[model samples]
Target: MAGILILYATIEGHTARVAERIAKGLRDKGYRVDLHRADPAGASLDLAGYEGVIVGASVHYGRHPGHLRALLRKHRAALAARRSAFFSVSLSARHKPAAAQRYVRKFLRRAGWQPQQAQTFAGALPYSKYPAWKRLLMLAFVGLAGGDTDMSRDYEYTDWDGVDRFADAFARPLDAI
Candidate 1:
């Protein structure tokens, strides 16, 4: 069996963590998986060897990473041809579900790629990791969203169970295909 590919683009690392969790879920199901970063600096990747692909990205400032967009555009056809899934990680998805749905739609529309499954996962706020300006900006956003404003401590809103369910569902398609 061809292995699965789990690719992600992360800004503050939450998306990377989410991707790892998804990979773990698939691995637990007895599937071989390759976890990779979607950064443009890395070597080129293709979908030829993968039975299925899972793509993930973190939303920052209401936008996903530019590299993710480019990768989606570059591989849309290959992705559409395979059993694939997409997940978006963002703080806004927890605060404002409707806007998060829009963000995902916009991303797919722009990339002209639609996967077989899609999910939205809440991301973490690592205040300690952000620079001063970003921390201040996030503080304001969190305040407006009625979220935790304690910059001294980080907050993680991702639901691990939901991630597990999504990963399992994605793997089911691989079995049928």
Candidate 2:
């Protein structure tokens, strides 16, 4: 079976965990998977070997990482030729679905690569991982947005079941191939 490639960019680790879950879900369905971090300085990967590809990244300050965008642009043709999907992780996905969708739209527009499937997943607020200033900034932002403001503990908003469903949907087409 041709492998599926799971490429991701994470900040604060939640997106990485999401990627891992997707990889696990695909593997459970008996698909070979190759998981790799999307690095800006790293050498380009050959997307030809994979039967399908799933790209995921988290939003910070309202944008997905620039490196991931550059990577997508660099390999846009190869990505378009294969079965592919893009998933975005953001806090807005939980509270502001339209905003999350906008982010995804803006990202794909800038990258110039539209995949077969796209989704938005809620990310976490890891207060402990942020520095003092960022933590305060995030706290204020969340407060204004009517989200979790408790700094004493972290909060995760990702819907794992939704993620599983996305993986299943993406895999079905590949299974048919």
lDDT of 2 by residue, 62-103 (tens): 999998998899899999899999999999999899999999
lDDT of 1 at 56: 94
lDDT of 1 at 142: 92
Reference-based lDDT, residue 1, model 2:
60
User: For every candidate structure, what is the RMSD over all alpha carbons to the true structure, in angstroms?
Assistant: 1.4, 1.0
| Residue 159, model 2: Cα distance from true site in angstroms | 0.5
lDDT of 1 by residue, 1-177 (tens): 458999999877889999999998888888889999987664467888898999999888888877777778888888888888889999888989888888899998888898889899999999999999999999999999999999999899999999999998888767765
TM-score on alpha carbons, each prediction: 0.95, 0.96
Taken over the whole model, the C-alpha lDDT of each candidate is 0.88, 0.92
* Number of the top-ranking candidate, with TM-score as the measure: 2
